[model samples]
Target: MKVKYWTCHSDGCAANVHIDKNDHFIKSHGQHHHIPEPEQIELRNLKGKVKERVITETSSITKIYEEELARSNLSSTALTLAFTAAEG
Candidate 1:
């Protein structure tokens, strides 16, 4: 199919931003080299929220495992094997 687009001129970038005759900006077709300031701040905030959730979940899992180990009679080797199998 014949497609119409504009090539970005930034170094090491291969962006093909679409250009419609009636519109100044449409859709882009590559990894964006730069994000606008507002978008950058929003992305950073999202990253922070994700990191926080990961840390919280990891801590909770660790606490549960520690409690289970303390309360159960399973040997360390058995626990290790069980975890290894679960991982796979």
Candidate 2:
């Protein structure tokens, strides 16, 4: 499955937002703050400082996934069974 995400450009804010495929907000880091206006939302190529923020957010997502997996009791076998059940 493909997961969608949003990365905002704001200083001291490494807010990596995970969203549903339909663009519905799922979760985020940094702060539960409101999103900026479209004009305020910086749109630029990944370079220098912006690149650093991207790397940091990527690492944060990895950590979050690891924590979630550890807390969940489902094993690989159980996940397979669940997928099969859903498919049927």
Candidate 3:
């Protein structure tokens, strides 16, 4: 059976998520060593949305960014983090 591995993002984390071809969860291994960061998660999702739009649209990065930011409804903390990352 074809499967995909979704590994943990935290440093030194050994956790992993396995999914089958149909995107059904097969099983998980190990465990996360840190608590979930909701704000960071929101920022990651926002980046993903922008990336998908960038791939499918001819719009300028600035325009796409503005549009996505408007629709994202991210928390203030997430917004601050996003802008800080962009500046770096």
Give one digit per residue, the lDDT tens place, for model 1 in 1-88.
Answer: 3346876555677877775676567678887586533433433444455456556676665455555545444455555554564368
lDDT of 3 at 6: 98
Give candidate 2's total backbone clashes.
Answer: 0
The Cα error of candidate 3 at residue 78, in Å, is 1.1
> What residue runs in model 3 are displaced by over 4 Å at the alpha carbon?
none
TM-score, each model? 0.28, 0.33, 0.87
Which 10 consecutive residues of model 1 have the lowest summed lDDT? 36-45
Clashing pairs in 2: none
Error of 2 at 76 (Å): 56
lDDT per residue (tens digit) for residues 1-31 in model 2:
4569877656556778888888888887666
Q: Is candidate 2 or candidate 3 better by lDDT?
A: 3
TM-score of 1: 0.28
lDDT of each: 0.55, 0.51, 0.91
Worst 10 residues of 2 by lDDT: 39-48
lDDT of 3 at 81: 88
